[model samples]
Every structure is written in C-alpha cells, then in structure tokens.
Target: MVKIVALVGTNSENSTNRQLLQYMKAHFANQAELELLEINHLPLFDKPADKKVPEVVRQMALTIESADGVVISTPEYDHAIPAALLNALNWLSYGIYPFVDKPVMIIGASYGTLGSSRAQAHLRQVLDAPELKARIMPSSEFLLSHSLQAFDENNELIDQDMVAQLEGLFEDFLVFMQITSQLGHAHSVNQKLAESVSWENR
Candidate 1:
C-alpha cells in the first residue's frame, strides 16, 4: 500500500485547513495507508541545540523519511505561509533533508478572498530548494472568500464541486508518486549496476 503523510500546518483546533485535510484523508482511508502529522507539537527551531533534538522533531523527521509522499494543507498568514509551517520545514531540513526529492503536494485554505494563494506561492518558493521534489497540481483553484461559512459545524465539506476537485487532485497525486517512486528505484538499480561493473573490471 502507498504510504502517505498528511501534514497539517495550522495550530488552531478549528482550523479549516485541518478539516479539509482530514476530509482528504477520509477519501484515501481504505485505498492507502495514511498518517497525519500536525505541526502543533513541533517546537521553534534552535540552531544551538542541534545535537539534542526534541523528541517531537525527531519523530517528525522519521515520519517524513518513511512516507512515500506528502500532502500539506496550510493557511496563509500575513500574506505568506504561517510561521509554524516554516518551523516544521526547518526541523526537517536540518539533519537528513527528508523532503529532498520527496514527492509533495500542497493545498491551502483561508477565509480571505485570496484563499491562501499567497501562502501557497511562498510555500512553493521554500520547497524549491534544489533537493526538494515539489509536485505542482494542474488544477490550481482557490477555495475561499466564505470557506468557513460554507462548511458546517462538523467541518464536513459542503460544496459538491469542491469535494470533487479535491478528490481528483489526490487521485492524480497518488499516480504521480507511484510513477516517480518507480523511476527513483530504477535509477538506484542502474547506479548500483554501474558501480559493480566498474569494480569487477578493476
């Protein structure tokens, strides 16, 4: 089964982004092995304490490393990605660069008109690091300007079309991850073969 880690970037208990991500998780409940990683547990990054990392940070790194792919749901704050998300990324990048070359899909939600578009753009920039493999979804549309009001108290997605779009994005992301993983495995096999042949000839 495909292992997917759903990263929720909001700290609020009633975060719309979190709710949306949970909805996506439900869609893949039986089809894929899903794990949720919330950013609330992560402490602020500290360069000085590099040798003794917090347990939460250590766990976060392990999760990112083990997952076949990642799905991030975030909210825009001050026209950019939230500080919490940035902190989590900092932790992930410190040791092993867990996100490097890892398949990632990002989605954003907000109550403003922009629907976290600016934040998403900022996130894309951060993930543009040479080693990171960020997957850009073809259907890029904002779900906002009344997002909170549209959803019910239970956090269930009320709009049918919105639900359909999210489902399609997840489906496409799963396919993209599978193909890329196979390609990576193939590349690794070829490199090993080349090394073995060189050693044998020597």
Candidate 2:
C-alpha cells in the first residue's frame, strides 16, 4: 500500500480540518495507509543558532521523508494558512529537506463559502520555495465548505457529490505518486540544493 502522511494544519482541538483528514484516513484505508500527523505540538520556530532541531521534529521529518506522498489539510486564518502549519513547515525545512521533490496533495476545509481557497493558494506558493520544492498535484483541489455540516455521525462525508469528488482526487493522487516517483532524476540534486540554501546570504 502507498504510505501517505496527512498533516493536520491546525492546533485547535475542534478543527474541522483535522476531521477532514480523519475522514480520508478511514475512507481510503483499503487503498493507502494514511498516517495523520499533527502540527499542534511543534514549538514555535525560532531559527536557532545551533541549527539543531528538536528530536520530535526530526522524527516527524523522517516519517515524512519516507512517505510516498503527503496530504496537507489546511484551514484559512486571515485568508492564509494557520501559524501552526506554517511553523511546522518552517521546522521541516530548516537544515532538512524532507519535502524536496516529494509529491504533495493539498486539501482544505472552511466554514465559509470560499472553502480556504486563499490558504490553499498560499500553501502552494510556500511549498514551491527553494528549501521545500514539493511536487504538488496539478489541477487538483478538494475543498470542503461549510465543513461543520460536511460529515455525519459516522465521521464520513455526508454529501454524495463531495464523496465522489474526494474519491476521484484520491485516485488521481495515487497515480500522481507513481508518476512523481519516476520523475526523481533530479531528486538528489534538489535535496542538496535545498540543504545548501543560505539564510546568512539573504
């Protein structure tokens, strides 16, 4: 089975973003092994002088590095991704290159109508940074609007159309993973370049 790391992009206990990931985990259990990673416990990124990362953060990086792909479920805060998620990404990129050339799938949930469109766009830009270089799926997006009513008592998506959309995107992701795995001729170079990014020169 394909191994996927799903990042829960919020610190809130009642986050619908997390709920959306949970639903994906269960729904895709047969096709992929989805592990939900929480960004809530990561300490605020401080750009430490020693350049030593927390063991927990390192472990998180290791897990992400070994995954076939990543799924990030984000929520908009001030029309952008939450600070917690951004902080986690900061940690993941500092002196580490887990995201370099890694395949990524972006998803989002929101209570409002825009369905975190701005945040998803912002996330794509962030992931494309030289230090990250994640290969986000093209022409694909899964947005769950009015997320409070998107699920049911069984923790499954309530709307058939929404479920169908998710299923199609997920299938596309599986194919994308395979395609990206073969597009790794420059993977090592990308990782090295990402590691060599110098903040002191900036």
Candidate 3:
C-alpha cells in the first residue's frame, strides 16, 4: 500500500493544524495509507550527546524513510514555524537523511487573517537544506483566517469550496509522488546492477 506520513507540528490537543491534516488524510481514504507523526515526543537536539539518539527521534526518522511522501501541517508561532517542527527536522538531519530528495508538501493553518503566511515563508527557507527538496504550495493554497471555525470536531471540512480545492491539491500531489517513486526505484535497480558488475570484475 502507498504510505504517506502526515506530520502535525502542534502539541495542542485541539490544534487546528491537526484538524486540517486529518481532513487531508480523509481525502486519501483507501487510495493510500496515512500515518500521523507526532512531534511532541521528540527531545531537543544536542550534537555533543548525539551518540545516543532519542527513541522518538529514531522512530520519526524510520517513519519518514518508509513513507512514499510527507505532508507537513504546521501552525504559525510568532510569525514562524513552530519550534517543535524545527526540532523534528533537526533530528531527521542525522545519518538517515530522511528528507533527502523526498517528496514533501507543506500546509499551514492559523486563526490569523493571513493564515500563517509568514510562518509558511519561513518554513520554505528552512526546508531549503541541500538534502531536502520541498514542493511548497503557492500562497493561495495556505488555509487560514477561519481555519479554527471552518472544521467541526470530527475534522470534516465544512466549506464546500475549500474541500474541493484541497481535494484537487492532494490529487496532484499524489500523481507527482508516484512519478518520483518510479524514478527512484529505477535508479536503485541500476545502482545495484552496477555494484554486481563491479564484483564480477574483481
């Protein structure tokens, strides 16, 4: 089954970003398996003590490594991505390099009128690490303003137009990920063949 890990960066139990992510997951239904990555459990990064990585951090990396793609749902905090999200990204920067060439998409939701626009922009910059290639959506795709009031407790989107737009965005993202996965598989097979040929020559 195709798997996509949805990362929610807020620790709040009633976070609107989490609700938005749940709505996105609903769009996939049986087409893809969705796993939610909780960022609250990760400890802060410290290079000196990096020899022993936290279990939560390691689990997060493994999840990202196994997934076909990632969808990050974040809320604005002082005009920037939440520290929890940044911390999670830092932990993933270890040897695993889970985000390397991974198909990733970012969505932000907030109660503010701009809907976490500043935070989204800041995140786009941080995700520009050499190991990661992020496919950030345009400003129009940012869900904000009445995000908290837009969805019910069940995480079902109440706005018809918003639901339609989100569906279209997810459809396009899935197609893009499929193409990328095909190319990655081909590359891996070619590399394995090259290794075998080298051993035969030896």
Candidate 1 per-residue C-alpha lDDT over 121-182 given as tens digits, one digit per residue, 9 for 90 to 100: 88888876533434444455445545686577776678878778777777888887877676
TM-score of 1: 0.82
lDDT of each: 0.73, 0.94, 0.72
User: lDDT tens digits, residues 131-183, model 3?
Assistant: 34344434435565578688877778888887787777777778878777765
- List candidate 1 segments past 4 Å from native: 131-145, 185-202
Cα lDDT tens digits, model 2, 1-202, are 8999999999999999999999999999999999999988899998878879999999999999999999999999998999999999999999888999999999999999888999999999999999999999999888899999888999989999999999999999999999999999988889889979975566
What's the C-alpha lDDT at position 188 in model 2?
Answer: 85
Single out the weakest 10-residue window by summed lDDT for candidate 2.
193-202
Candidate 2: residue 122 Cα off by (Å): 0.2
- Global fold similarity of model 3 (TM-score): 0.83
TM-scores of all candidate predictions against the true structure: 0.82, 0.98, 0.83
lDDT of the structure predicted as candidate 3: 0.72
How many clashes show up per model?
0, 0, 0
Candidate 3's C-alpha runs over 4 A off are 131-140, 183-202
